[model samples]
Target: MFVMGHNQLPPHLKKFRRLVYISPVITILSLSLLVWTYSSDMTFQFITRYYHATSDPQTPVQFTLPLHRGPGQMGPEEQKLSLMAVNGTKTVLVAAYQEHRTGQKEVRIIAVVLRSETVAYRCLLRCQEQLRISEGVSTTHSDHFGFAYGTADIMCPLPLGCETASHVTVISAASDSNDTQIQEFLEVKNQKVQSDSFPYNFVVCLSTMFDFTNVLQLVQSLEMLQLLGVNRVVIYKTSNSPETQRILDYYIYKGFVEVIPWSLSKFVNVSRGWLPEHGPGDLHYLGQIPALNDCLYRYMYQSRYVALQDMDELILPQSVNSWLELVPLLEMKYGEDKCYMFENNVFPNTVSLPPPTSQTLPPPSCCPGWENVSGVNILAHLYQEPIITETHYTNFKIIVNPRAVFSTSVHGLLSSLIDCSWVDRNIARMYHTRASRQTELTEDELIYDGRLLSYSTKLIPNVNAVFRESGLLPEGSIQ
Candidate 1:
């Protein structure tokens, strides 16, 4: 039965047997090849390019050492290749080994490395290109190049000109490479940005040139303001009109002022209606008036506060010590959010008689303290109230609460669209009668000027009569 079964068993069965025998051996051999590729000390010492047999023109052949074996000799039978990373840089290791009677002996290993030589070459090209650009020799797109090797630093100092070609390009190229082992480098960047700290608070900008002789006196008047503290006091000129330009130049030369020329003639037009032949018949041209409408517009629209005044009207000391000392005291009495007016009492443009042989009843000193002193109210006397005569040259002292004030006119307005009870504080006073000997006026003339509609000189007989009538003083100085 066994002998007859050989041919009858059939061709298909024989083929199946052959297949089973070959498949396992093929698999095992394939595995062995892989193992050898990984573990054997088979070095690909250098890379060289070779074209297929049918190339027309031969291309340049570049050779690079891909691996190096340490000095050792061994038989090929037991060599095993392995993979390794040196200094975090990936490399392939090919090991050599020998078979001893005991087992196997490792001889040496060769490391196959792919370095950044290409990068270095490209870097050289970039440097050359940069030189070309700097020299205006040629415009080329090949200005960027990158090369990296063996765990190089990210902040690599390029050899001068290489990075000058295009640092961003080089950085980008380095970023694109898969070799994460390379170090990244940064270039010196030049950019400036301003911080947001300045220009927050309100400002009172005084753009005038100070007259040297009278500047201290004028500043003293400004310094006497018991209201908000002065922000910036800029003096650009000194003296009256004839010497005004020269004084301005002097301040500019001394670096104490910024001169801005404004024509007094231009303002004459607005003043034609608002001002008399002299300045304001009631007050010195303070609060910018109508002349500096542009400055007023900017201040009203752009700035937080607007304080326009000239140099004479000063807030005199009441019971308080200095201007700085008076602000809080006044604020306490009249709520911190309020504006005030200090009525000026002095008459301007009066000349002294020659050599006062009899001693001109030492002109009535402009005084602040009087009887009946209260917050926001004081029965103070004035030589000439701007309210009456056409010569209303009396300056108005004002303290504007930034939050409550809007655009100013002949009078001030409130930002809040409602009317509130207005309180006056007499604790803050203004003395407006400091004048040169060149300017003086009799008490009778001051109190009872003929031009006044209500209180006229013709209506009153003398100083004694007026003082007695007003019940402010006794009849001692009156003749």
Candidate 2:
């Protein structure tokens, strides 16, 4: 009832009208600001919880989310991830990322595996920070094989007694609302048994054997390893002949050998030599470094010592017959934690013992099909290439305490938790049998060292039995 005209308003009335109009606008803005601040703080708190829950300060951090985002939307920090089945029940998720400049930045690794019916089980993998040269004594002087590699273990959540799982999707959490699918669900089978369950004293690790044609030599080498007291031989096989496969099967059945399918060809072109620059593969020495590291870890808790060597090489003890005796002697001279390196002594096949003059030679077709094998005949090759005093011997192999070795190369350990020294060739040395440097070397060039003669009595019969058992040789074939 007391409404005033627009032009004839009292001062008090005008002031009150202005106050009423301004108060509502100010109140609305203040309320809006308060709500926004509260929401922002809540969001920040949520993100912080996620970051701390899954990250480590000393190692790389992992982030996990429930949903996946497009690859285009991923931040620069997010790495390209992949999953490889190390064995049947265990799959190793591998990721390569930019090395943190500050060393303080966290790397978050969130892995999720899908069970049947789209049910997902989340896993937090702690990255085993790679061995850095600055951190400890690194024998690996070259960076030819350097890569920022990180691994996470995915224990398959399949039901009891199930060795494989199908249609598994692995997801990683990210900063964006969308989760990243690192790997699509594919068929995953358990290939490796628990390493802790392996009952072996001295395990021999042969890395990345490609295009294995030397069947006879392989069998002889295995037999010699057994003779030398090697309880188990693990070979990362790429491919081999049918004959070799049969031999491997025999050993596997006998529980003396383990063949890890080297599927590196599926990932990248594998080089045959350590110098990738001179070879075709991406990794040095047919990815030998990784395979050696894997073997070391696989046998760390299982075997007392693991010998890293080629299929054609044997670390023969000069005085002792079995490695069981040689190891204790070596450990006595060198501390137990030390990695023992053996000097390489190459013996070429061309300088073999003159065809047994005393005994009549059997017909060419009389022996098993494997008699015409591609590899060096260890029995025939008893003469070694004489050592040149001036030459710097670079080629050597190692027998290391699995727990002490952190990383390894074809020749020796790259990094060890303890000291490493060259084992005196007088006590033990590596006998490498291969094609002779020259077609014919004189008696002066060849040093007659018949170390293998001692094992021939047993090696010949054992190899013959395997050939017969595998149907490669007849029961009454050459005895």
Q: Evaluated with TM-score, which candidate comes out highest?
A: 2
lDDT of each: 0.31, 0.59
Model 1 ranges with Cα > 4 A deviation: 1-229, 234-259, 263-273, 276-306, 347-395, 414-425, 433-441, 444-479
Q: What is the number of residue pairs that collide in model 1?
A: 32
Per-residue C-alpha lDDT of model 2 across residues 1-479, encoded as one tens digit per residue? 12233557678967876878877456656866665666655766666678668866433222222223332232222222243432222223332111122123222111211111122224222223211111100122233453222122233232333323223433322222232223333322222333354567899999677888888888889989988999999887777766566567667655688877665556545567666456564446655665666667667667878898989899999899999999888989997746998988878866655433443442122235446555656877777887766422667888887766545666776656677778888899999898765455676667777777777778777776666655555545545
Clash totals in order: 32, 25
* Candidate 1 residue 346 C-alpha distance from true site, Å: 1.7
TM-score of each: 0.32, 0.61
